[model samples]
Target: MSKRNRASVSLPKGVHRVISRGREYFYYQIGRGTDHEGDRIKLPNDPRSPEFWQAVRQAQGLIGQVPADTIGALIDAYETAWPGLPRKLTEGTREQYRRSLKVVRTAWGDLQASSLKPSHVQALIEKLGANTPGSANNVLDALRAMCRWACGPRELLDRDPTQGVVHFDRGEGHRPWTPEQLSYADEHLTGMLRRAYVLARYTGQRASDIIRLGWTDVDDGGFGLRQKKTGVRPWCPIFPELDTEMSKWERRPGPFLLQDNGRPFTTNQLWKVFNAAREETPLDGAVWHGLRANAAIRLRQANHSIAAICDMLGMSPPIVER
Candidate 1:
């Protein structure tokens, strides 16, 4: 039982320290003149091991750095990251950015602004593509915008990783509902949602704008409201047919056509109820938003002037062409 036991050891020096193990350990420094802290750390076995602790040591260099030390800084870094951009966008566009932030936070929200790398951007765009093809390009656009905001106005990064990303389908811009489809949808739907759909077809307002519509906007068989998306104003005399429908709803509180729990509807929440309502209707391929596009296409088909369409739809002329 008295067999001798021995251990092999070797040490290296240079900005390094020694550590000991067992019941006790001793401190030693290669340079006596230096007043650095004691180096009696417990020696890790297999210094060449794949699990070596050197990685932790390497990270120690970044201990005292700030967000300015990396390119991954927060949204506040830019005085106007997308200042006028956000305002120019409609409430719907702002909501999209809010959603985009969720994905960014999940990816690298904690990293400093200066440390964001092209690789990180590429990875994020790839993931966006995988998760939501239709929205993937949009996410890429948002991320690129954030990076531009973070990178300063001088175009800091060598190449924007998201620059060339293509949409999942090039032709998915708009899919308008035909009159036959609208008729079928209306016949299938009843109550407020049907009327809402009718309004969407005529007004061409985005669901975001449509939900906020109220009785106050209507007057003498016509309605007037400021379009949120384009900041344009359009006043349309309600068609005689629609006028009859509005006359019946004089008892509701406030001005909005759609309501949630008796309050005005929000864009995010209305879709669920809209979808549920659609299931009962004969409408297929008719998304809540499709109503807006359908209305636009119909307006165009009716030879409504481009400017009139833009004002009524709250979109720019360029958007209408797109």
Candidate 2:
């Protein structure tokens, strides 16, 4: 109770003692420049006990030994190297990898690539699958590809962490847009959004390819472009509906679908615009990609052969069959 007895006692530089409700509590700062920066560990036991010192020592050891070969580093290297390889990744595939890598980095960016075990990969997949199994599987695929790249060219690791890991079963698949939903969009969405929807339904191309369609791509009676995702060049005929939609807009030198400011839509911009229109309709569980499936189904309903469908959609026979 005297001033001399209450005088501060020395502890570790990063450790501090405080009194709350007349009880002393000890906490240790894990330090800066690490993933655990600003993190503090409270020692429940008495500071005079051996256990408290043991915990302190362990926390101190992790302070300045951050690993160099982190998951973030490996992903950065992979992104840089992937485009330069002889067999380069496609633009769409690269975008997919980038998105999945973002999710993985949020969870374990600073974690050492060499320290990852199959159990760690499995745990991540399980945690992600609880919310969205399809997304979990996509992340697993991205990790597997990154690990393979690291082993093959980067030589960052000798073994794959994703080797024994399995993906969650995403039951079923994307549903095709129904006629009623299409009608709803036609009535609700106007101008550029409507044209985009019409173009997707007619062409059966991915959103990436659709966004790149320009007036120059149009020819005598159809438009042709090499599909970005599959590398297949498809020349699809200009159906009556698509032609009618095109005639309503003045031809510009740029993309077929332009923003009000006369610029083509970036992938994100296109999705935002399309989703905004979609939200105004009475459809549920419908998506832009489903329009591609609708095109394939429409071709099938018209008694087209699998080969014809594949040619029209710029897809493989197996994908058409599916």
Candidate 3:
């Protein structure tokens, strides 16, 4: 907070100390150019710590004109506005926002929110498309939600650059794993993979619910889970096989069926294992999520009504059709 501490602090090239109206931070060219100022910005936050500043300075030593304190204020404002939003988005929705913000940070970390344009939003959508169609849509949806929250009530985006983006046409819901694939998964998947996959295949529950399933949820032969994705609380008759599987593992393993390095498996980590199993499984197109699809398909095949499968999966009628 003193001039000595500030002076001893070396900044990236083009970055300088900026102190305005009792606030302090730093700034730099978010966009590259000569004679053009305010093209870039930054602030003192987790990402822009002293170590990062040193890296930037080493890369392009002592840049002129950009003020560091100003950048810090911008950083503060951007981060500050995020949590201030009023909406109580579901946990799944919050995760979506977090993922979207990561894209924004990676793309425009140096720019102030005022500097964001339709093109920046468009480019973020494009980068997201490189992954999956669903992921791209998620990034767009999350960004639009955040912008709306920041700009004010009523869909504040005039252009909504991501609005017109077309996602890939997925199949009429995912195809369930074939019999051979199921057999292979049963045989090949070991430890927690076996437990997780079996629960998914049997209950048709989302990964969110499946990971959080506990003894308390299991009553008599049916289990109760409030599906986080859909906010649906449904009681599903536990598959007899599921009971056998549960008996095999230690209970109260503290919430999650799978543990990695003694920590409960996160959805992200589950996907990683799922991807690996997909590669190994002869069922070429089936995903880890396809286990749920498999259960749905099996229920339908065994003469369960549409409503029954929907209830089991905690999906709405329309979602079940999709």
Candidate 4:
């Protein structure tokens, strides 16, 4: 976080400070009024800010050069660690990051991560978003995720360059279920609907993974399986909620959850049935995918850290942070 400089601020050589309307601003006036020199240039407001120093340096053509170790090195390190990282980077996401990092690498591979600022990020977003808003948002997500991961768990960077930056406002993707909506749905839930609801809520897994789970996968400890998206094998301990809900259900052979015909439900088939059941209730717009986000919210309400939730859900940092 950049804190504003209050008093006793220092100025670089040839830079003048002015106080107007009780606010401090900086300017360069060394060669002003000269035939060869252009008009005086106004500099950034905060002397302590990176923008302030960058402005001063650039004005004098004294731009500090990046050292041998650069943003490319950090991106390489992130790429190397991608496979074994605890957070889930799906196949598509891995490719997306690869492409996005390539773009960043091509743009500033020789530059230091510290050289990036919110202004640079915003400019990139504006440029890329001119054609495809989603593409711009995806690039920002890649940058934010990589920077956050570097700054947080990996300790690769002192600070996240993407901090204080905002991504494009992609509309609310998945709407999580409210407690009232979930509770009401529980009352109306039965058969596969009841089974799906219990599994999704308790396991904190997506519908694709949930529909795939069979009775053979469950154990005394919990449900154990490698998640479809992340390929992470997590022990999803059966919650008391699931236990209470399933106590009412008769345990059957084959898959733990099945259609009325007792066959396994495909992901699409499961969602169509689930959505139909949800329509009976007053709640609207809540989808099967929202259960994952709702599970995150529930765990967060219980004081779980974002990292813990991401790990538990096998989600990427970008998705979980959002």
lDDT of 4 by residue, 1-322 (tens): 1223324444555787777886776787666556666547788765544355556656776667534346776675566456556565786578778888887888778788777877888888888888877788878888888888778654557787776767677765677888788888778777777788778877789887888877677877578877775677767667788777667766667667777776788887987886676675755677777888888778778887777777677776677767
* TM-score, one value per model: 0.64, 0.73, 0.64, 0.47
lDDT per model, in order?
0.57, 0.76, 0.64, 0.72
TM-score top scorer: 2
Instruction: Show the lowest summed lDDT stretch of 10 residues, model 1.
Output: 1-10
* Model 2: per-residue Cα lDDT at residue 290: 88
**Cα lDDT of model 2 by residue, 1-322, tens digit:** 2222323233667777767886677788856456767678786334433345556655677565444477765665566455345576777677788999999888888787788888988998999899999989989998998888678644788899999888886554678888899889878878878878888999888888888998899877888888877677887788898899888878768788888897888778988877665664566668778888888888888899998788778987866777
Steric overlap count per candidate: 15, 0, 19, 0
Q: Candidate 4 clashing pairs?
A: none
Better of 1 and 4 by lDDT: 4
The lowest-lDDT stretch of 10 consecutive residues in candidate 3 is: 68-77
State model 1's lDDT.
0.57
Better of 2 and 4 by lDDT: 2
Which whole-number lDDT from 0 to 100 does residue 126 have in model 1?
Answer: 71
Q: Write the per-residue lDDT of candidate 1 for residues 1-322, one digit (tens) a residue.
A: 0111111212234223323453322223334357764443343333322122232233334354333322333432322223333345555455676577667756775575456666776677777677676566666656776665544444444445455554465455557786777778657767667667777777777776677677777756656777665456677657665666666766655645555467666666777777776674456567766777776777788898888777667677876776
- After superposition, the stretches of candidate 3 with alpha carbons farther than 4 Å from their true spots are 1-86, 111-120, 153-173, 247-253, 256-263, 271-285
| Residue-level lDDT for 61 in candidate 1 | 40
RMSD of 3: 9.8
TM-score of 3: 0.64
